[model samples]
Target chain A: MSKKRLPNIIAVTLMFAMILLAGCAAQPSGDLEVFSWWTAGGEAEGLEAMLEVFAEQYPDIVVINATVAGGAGVDARAVLATRMQGGDPPGSFQVHAGHELIDTYVVADQMESITFLYEEEGWLDVYPPDLIEILSYDGEIWSVPVNIHRANVLWYNAGVFTEQGLTPPTTMDDFFAVAEVLEDGGIIPLSLGESWTVVHLFETVLLGSMGPDAYSGLWNGSTDWGSSQVTQALENFDRMLDYVNEDFAALSWDQATQLVIDGTAAMNIMGDWAEGYFKAQGWTPGIEFGWVASPGSSGAFDALSDSFGLPKDAPNRDAAIAWLRVCGSKEGQDAFNPIKGSIPAHTGGNRGLYDQYLQSAMDDFASDAIVPSLMHGAAASPSWQQDIIDAVALFLGGRDVSAFQAALVAAAGDAGY
Target chain B: MRINRDRLIAFLMILPSLVAIAVFVYGFIGWTARSSVSAWEGLLPDYTFTGLTNFIDLFNTPRFQIDIRNTAIFTVLFISTCLILGLVLAVLLDQRIRGEALFRNIYLFPMAISFIVTGVVWRWLLNPATSLERLSGLNLLFHQAGLDFLISKWYTHPSFGIVAIVIPATWQMSGFTMALYLAGIRSIPEELREAARVDGANELVIYRHIVMPMLKAITLSAVIILGHTSLKIFDLVMAITQEGGQGYSADVPALNMWYTTFRALRFGEGAAIAIVILLTVAVLIVPYLVYTFRSEVEA
Candidate 1:
């Protein structure tokens, strides 16, 4: 009798497994999953603070803060892709503002346009129109940007500058003059870090040399990459590299920032996260360290943002919309951006809550000629950025500016610029 | 009836694992292979038959070319250094030295920790390259030791940066190779050495003529193991250099494949790279598999 019942047991177990799989297909309506790469330091803390605000506002909805941490969304994007492709997108996810948002999700039709949400929240008056344009594609906006990170900040050691009787340079000619004085005085004029930082520095140089409109044209295909202006920018970048430390390839962005704080180098041109790093290391911003809108790009804001988008078929539609509302709200931006070390994407943020450097960043964001940053995910597709990275990497080794420019033109062509 | 029942039960026991391997392993491999030959460029899976376009593009690309060169240099350096050092260590240990167990444990400890862990530690030791004023890590140590001339730019060096990466790879893996060789050394019967000595052969001659010859199988195993690891090196290089060191100098095929697929979102190109890596590994492994199976059958 037991032997005959064995097949029956097997059939029952198979049926149970099928039932379990079927049961998992029905997601709970009260659950909202927010996926991101913010799993460390102030960024993580800021994410939690926003979540707290979200939780207080909606107590019934259970949020799963699903984070796969790697610096700058490297691992998180990979995980997000796998989930989105497998038809299991989270309720919401953090992404860079422009092309990363557009080329990855919007084009793939993974994200639902959040234009209705923006209008419902009355965000049109709060968010700058230009920023909204960055977040939109094909006449529809998708993601709600939370914080704007400025890419063209030139950070320097205030003590070193004071002792040398020098001020921060405002133009390309002024920069080289200052750089030369510091070099002659046995100081490395600039501190550059690894490859990506070089790209960051190069972008600032490009912006400063050509000004904002021409710089913006490089991405939109209006500016010819082989133009004399681009050549001048390349020559400037090559000159800028000469002022960097000999062992720059070994340092990271933070390490390079540390060079400024340590006064081993007078300057470091990096994103505003360098300010956060300095504060973490017990240096007060605008006192121990000083920042300028990287030389020649003073009147411009080279910006990238961390934004959240609602995916199609979200598990908790209402909760996800509520989450996005918080992401774009003045209160949410105030709570998040201060700790997150970025300026608020929403212009209505409380400036009094921010520090000195951040208040200045806010001022710059409000008034400066805003342009999308290529180093971060604003101006180009992910593939185009990789091409730039590879070209820059090769150029660093070879220092062939003409070849580098040619490569840029080729890359632009490939990207359909 | 008893025999039939026993066979059925045995089959039932292995059925789960067999099915899992078939579906998850072989099935995915087949899927990857199919995607590689298709024109799937973006997030959406378009399995339109594109036929080898991605492969052609990948080969023509300069970055991939650099990666292949870097991998070749890394493999040759990593394998040779590990084998020589491992054999040397094994020989030294076989001398019945005092604290032999202690030394052996210390040697094998690095292998126990992951390549990522080893890489994170080694990254600091090798970086901040060649600056006398800001020297730190091993570079600083070399400075104090009056070996300043010995200092080079570690993994940041343009021409030989991949060679610096090999140092860490060898440090992590040579211990395993040493363990294999040590076991091989111990297994070589004392009688054979005695007979060689009795025949007027010295210690050096015994090792060269008799002992080294006896460890041929062990060496082959070590080579096969280390060769495959060197060929598909990813995590260690990633943890250390992140972007395969400056100028694609330390890049491997696996690292390139990752960026192509995930970062750049070129699924077809990425899949093509994956198949290429698989083929490279197969070139190393299939012959070994065949040899091992044949040897087992003969035994």
Candidate 2:
């Protein structure tokens, strides 16, 4: 080859390489990347089942399961923030249904309004009106909620309860009575976990003490934070703390549930996900463990739903819309919720697929007065939720009830309550 | 002309790296400083100037106060323990003992691993309930051996949680400090020690007057490295204690910054924290850099 021809050949090769690299950098038009924090156990399985349904519907589209593993989507949120700020967004991402979606993504204008999709699919008729209200901002729905989790379920060892001749508590008085018996019998009355779980328990206690209407008012500025009822709730929480496991700070929610599973503790207040954890441990629902609507919250469902939304500049917009459609469908809900241990967000979900506990939860969800869960990001903004967590942490350390109430009020003010 | 051309070529060779550092490091820092003074509270970058509010709020928050206290406790304990233990180990190794390589390697192995790995391993080793007790039945052994007093609530201790974190931090870093001291000790001329001994100075006297003063520069370097690390410590705390570590007892500023920025979407507050950390590290490092540069020029 001639020397001049060599330079031309080198230029041609470089151009080809550049084109190949650019092609590699671009996402395939038919590929949908679903980002979430479900990386373990039943949650991961449920996500896979949903993806399988999506894949079956659209054989041409490839689904990318980009799961960032951490307890409560902590790491995944950080990754999503950076990616979105850097002008790259996944096709769709999992977010808690209410203010977590509204305040974090929608207010920031990072989420694309899926009101059109909802209208086209007639999702407004299927999903609960209250949940739709939570997902909407400025008269447009932003997300497609997959499943509803009841945050105020009190799970207990049924055998232990029957052996001790104690009934499931339905009120604070009943709870304390059962606690007294459990403590006298040398068993932990409540199996509390780390900070978030403690926060979760406090929210349930607040719900029980304040009741559903007053509890919802706490987030919406109608309920005075320093009111007598709020004070009573705080005191109730303090009393509940007295009966919790001493090693509560070191354990995760599941580990705390393990205490109940092994009959070391009498009860644990957690979401329906705890049921999934128990089933994963090979424990039957009614025989091995039992659940109530938590003490003083019998007729109330403390609700937090997990939903997926389209990002503003999703690379695969069509695929994402299709995914959302699948998410809201009855078939998808049945396939996902039975495995996820969460009740379907849609009222039309098949009840036969659910276990006994979920069937009851679904029933309660239909007839019961529903209240938002603060710890699970339904009642308040993410900033307010974090502030409450910090305040709760301080409350746990010092047990100063008045100071905690003051902090909550201040945090609410800061979050524009 | 040839010399000028050679200089130009040399400048061209370094231009890419200089530009890269300028844009990536210093430029980003400037941008962060700008963000720190802004009113950006949520996911969107507002950039409206609201000077010092975030910093003022940070100073007022009880959680931030706890972070400062934890950082102070962690820094003092981590550095002092590593230095003292490192010096002792270096001195012992300097005795020219048998199987010296094995001992040295064993001492330095923790340093070879990342802080994240060290954190995870120590998290299990120092767990109050499920770790050593459940796995090896060491707590049971202690109880049977009547050494139950040896067992305590390790990382779970409320007041001393940051101190527990310090143990893992020191474990990963002390080996590096030891290697530094060992090199410093070995580099001291044998003639100085010999002269001191000839003058009827004892071993202790020789070490105090001759060897210790000679190792001053090494100590300063170690302090600067360790101080900066302690100021910006994040991963070890995140892995071991996490955000809710025993009522936020183990929270440091870095962890606080991360939570504020990402979780809460309070970018302004997070940027202020970053600036505070940067200024703190700069307060320690800038003087040393200046001194080193001046000394190099003099030499």
Candidate 3:
């Protein structure tokens, strides 16, 4: 109340304000921040549904559904990285299962090894071994995958295919033959989207050309990127590029799928997420559209799983564990994946919950050999992945297959593969 | 004694901003400079001095090289087009034509919109899709107008994609440049123009000889403003042609820096890019500051 003490009060208040503004402020008790990029229709609803399960399990805890909206975690990952760098990580955050989770967080020492969670919950037996493999680094499990998305689905307009009396292409030769017929018939043979989707298509082409083993070999030291097989794959991607819509650069992945839906394009190489886009547009899976494994990639599942992990020093550690458990549990994944339009990461998920398309995906995911997706951050480090994206973007303009292959070789060398 | 007290009060009033700028501006800049030279990567900081390794590596990278080239093209085209277009619009408005305020608002409306919106709107207006089914923008207009030869791939053109970016940049900034030039033109004495007309100078000659030359300062300011924005463009490029068009044909250094630092967690390289951009802008601005200060002192 005294005039002389007023300056002291002001100075003390300023210091407190600065501290609060600098993110040292504590969170409210029982509050948890679950971070993700699932801001779109079904995926967002899917996340909400899983959170409802978590809510039922832990009614006392409050969940903050933090989201950053971008396709393929483009903007979200960057925001998450900065937040972690600032030492203000969310309680649990969505991350891709493999090299993305390892190289960005685990290797950087920002993530806790949730291997204990796996042990405590008996997840070691329930989750698929390959999914466990991708989630592990340095003998430690880093995250729990919620859903598995097949990244190599070749969805075609069934009407277009039937009109041409053609089955969906199952081999490289079949693809080109189908493409020629479609292109000659004035339909864009393949609908492609922007740069990242192009990278996605290129990944499937590589898998299709080389099969799962050789394609998987590209990421490890086993396969040579400059090998004749990769060269053939690059050539295939180049020729496929010629068959894509001329305005491919201007369209997003959904827009590309729309091209197939409207019958402007005959086929599209996209992830299973396109199935969600198709259904959202009122096109039924078996009726309006048909899907096959991308050419020559049959019996191989090119997989990318959207997983959630606990960061070190998370504010709500107990709540985060609860959240992770929900992410990995059979009850939660079945709730989430049915709405998310993807199959469950937990093999014990309810089979009847998924629809016609995801059931087939689940079958393929069970029987087929699994290879990691390059574009979705499983096969390579983010840096190396960016290099390939840039290389693909460049190759798109130039159509120089050898140059693209050389760039891939260089990128692999840089990644120390 | 009273005057000295007043001066002290003024200094005290400014002290907070001065100290804030010293810490937040120059201090952070210094911090960035230090971080750029560190061997940091992957969401963690390592200040082990790495010399010029980041800069050298960036220079050697093909993407960075393409970025520098794109920046060069963007800066030159953006500044030149903004200046010329701004000057022309200003001159046309100076004719005291009908609905001058209306035309002025129309020219300046794009400035009211952010670069993101401008980029988005222009993205639709200048779409490069050559296929009829996909062509709905400027290309479609060109087709309808029987100007098919003028229908370019715009930003999708491999070598000249950044040039297409200039159209949007100019669309957004030329209004600002026009306002500046219009102010410059209006500030020139009406009597001088009247005297020139009395001395038998034609309208074109009066503008070229008197009004245009007097806009030299405005031109310099416009160039610096437009040049720097073009140098470190991010949001506009992000909105339009995010994959850098095709093959990063429209990619700028700012976009690359963003991806490197935030996406790839190459903080050192990203900071190096930020510093490079700052230095390039400083190159454009430092001399202008010196000249303006010297002129103020002379005055």
Candidate 4:
């Protein structure tokens, strides 16, 4: 009888073993799901490079790449919110500079403090002091800075510049002069993308055109829309719109850059990420593509930095922190920013390690007084930025400066900015 | 009394659908209504009741007003065009035409693709450069005729925004209505067609008097389905026009709600928009649904 009962015991033991195995398998070791919006043309390759290095450092940590592609942060943030609200937050996610998070991240205390990481990495001494200041809230670090993207760079085709017998425009007047020359030469003057982000290019020009103090004043509410500086900036932005592609409203960013790459358009006002696109197309930067400061900014740069934040209640909190460390590390920066085609946020990040255009960007970033871009949802309320988009759209579509300014004033009032 | 086991099984079978409605449908509505009354941001809902504040702000928004007007115009035009075109195709296909299977499948296939996919493909087709380039490549015929105007930056033009919204919607939904009409036509008894023919009625007369009247039930069903879909239209408008709110012309209430909740991080206001849109759709659809249910009971 005891022998017959042995088979039953064996079956029960097998079932228990299976359950134990399943439970063990469900327990992940240092697995982190990283969320970001860098899933387009060249950004994808850059992200892959960063992940490759990350994998090399912590071979046990599994990194899940969750990227949503929309021109702006809209698509990525939307997906992240839905997930977080559904109680499945990613270990880390990308957020921009300024108060974009106050409404959600700060209120919920969902952001984890990365003070120790920043301090331990000695990033306090390396990255720009202003960047460190922006990342601070209530005297604690809440995110890891990844890369500094200068949004005001004007990229032009070298062949087009040569054919037109022109140099990269250094001032508003020069930009228009070159644009006129290019148009006369039967080349498209500017390759504006179809999204609302073209408003970013316009704002970059406006920021530089208004000068740093006046530009910062626009964000800090120190300057009124009635100011002559703002009025002139708006006028120039409107005039510049005339050179944009007729189909600018519907062209994607890559397509806009393609016109430059194909030598159809003379220049494109875009972020450094355009370098990634050019490189992906088998075109070497500084050879097929070139960069210049936004017109009116001789050396001033408009920059937006991308950073990663760990939500407070991340399941694998330690793992998430480790990933943030990797993101801010010199090795990680070298591996990531080259493909990101952005300047590294890591202090003493190896500039010699990057491609030529990015290296040049690093030089400019070092030499220039970088100003905040309003389009990055920094320095102003989202409502204010939204209003600016509306104001810009109306202005670009032929609204008078007075009406556009009124719209801005009204929006500022509405957003309590 | 004898137990009706079949009725019990039928109720059991319908239980999953009823739960789905309760959870996804009713649950979301209640949650959204509660959220609308509270100040919420990001993933967090602030339970503080700022009474009528969000609604007042939403009403004052010019973008919201434009979105409402665009939605209404789109709903009316989209429904009418889809019905008219669907009926034409249904009538023509019902005539025992050659390659009826092929034609039927061709008309029915658009229904199979999801709105997301439909929007993606249509976006490319409507892109001005892409369309013009493709058209010009067609032996200079289109280029000579200046057909470039047909493409005219359809997604961005305020005047053509509704047309842009309609094309993809009509592409996807017309197939559904066509199938309904086809089913209605097929359901007609053979004797009815024979009787019409024997009465010396021409094809148009037979269709107008006999076939069309027979299709009233199917047409009403089609209208109700399409009407509800039109009221809740989001994806096509979002895709064709970059969510339209960015430009201030293409903003639908759903897109507005999304922007408020996620982009703007004003969850209370976003939830308020959601509730308002929910009520609007409910007002349009609930009565029709009740009527349909009553008719089904009578039948």
Instruction: Tell me, by TM-score, which candidate is best.
Output: 3
Interface RMSD of each: 1.4, 2.0, 1.3, 3.7
Clashes of each: 0, 0, 1, 2
- TM-score of candidate 3 relative to the true fold: 0.94
For model 3, give the interface RMSD: 1.3
- Count steric clashes of candidate 2: 0
Please give, for residues A383-405, the per-residue lDDT of candidate 2 as tens digits.
88889989998887678899999
Please give the distance, in angstroms, between residue A350's alpha carbon in candidate 3 and its true position after superposition.
Answer: 1.1
Model no. 2, DockQ: 0.34
Q: What is the lDDT of residue A205 in candidate 3?
A: 94
Candidate 2 residue lDDT tens string, B1-299? 99999999999999999999999999999999999999988777899999899899989998998888988998899899999989999989998999988988898999888888877777667656533423223345566687877665556666667887888899888988999999999999999999988999998998889989999999999999999999999989887776637767788899899988888888999999999999989999999999999999999
Q: Model 2, which residues run further than 4 Å from truth? A: A1-29, B129-145
Q: Name the candidate, 1 or 3, with the larger DockQ value.
A: 3
Candidate with the larger DockQ of 3 and 4: 3
lDDT of 1 by residue, A1-417 (tens): 689999999999999998899678543348889999998899999999988887777777798989997757878999999999999989899999999889888999888998998887899888887788788899999999999999999998999889899999989999999999999988889999887898999899999999999998998899999899999999999999999997787678998888888888999999998889999989988888889989899889999999999999987887898889889988888889888888899998898889999999999899988899997899888888888988888887778999999889899998997
Clashing pairs in 3: A393-B247
DockQ for all candidate structures vs. native: 0.44, 0.34, 0.47, 0.21
For residues B1-299, what per-residue lDDT tens digits would candidate 1 score against the true structure? 99999999999999999999999989999999999999887689989998989899889887899988988888888899999999999999999999999999999889999989989999899865576788888989999999998787888876667998988888888888899999999998999999988999998998999989999999899989999898889999888888877677777899889988998888988999999988998999999999999989999
Sorted by TM-score (best first), the order is 3, 1, 2, 4
Task: Indicate the residue-level lDDT of A235 in model 3.
Answer: 89
How high is the CA lDDT of each candidate model? 0.89, 0.87, 0.89, 0.76
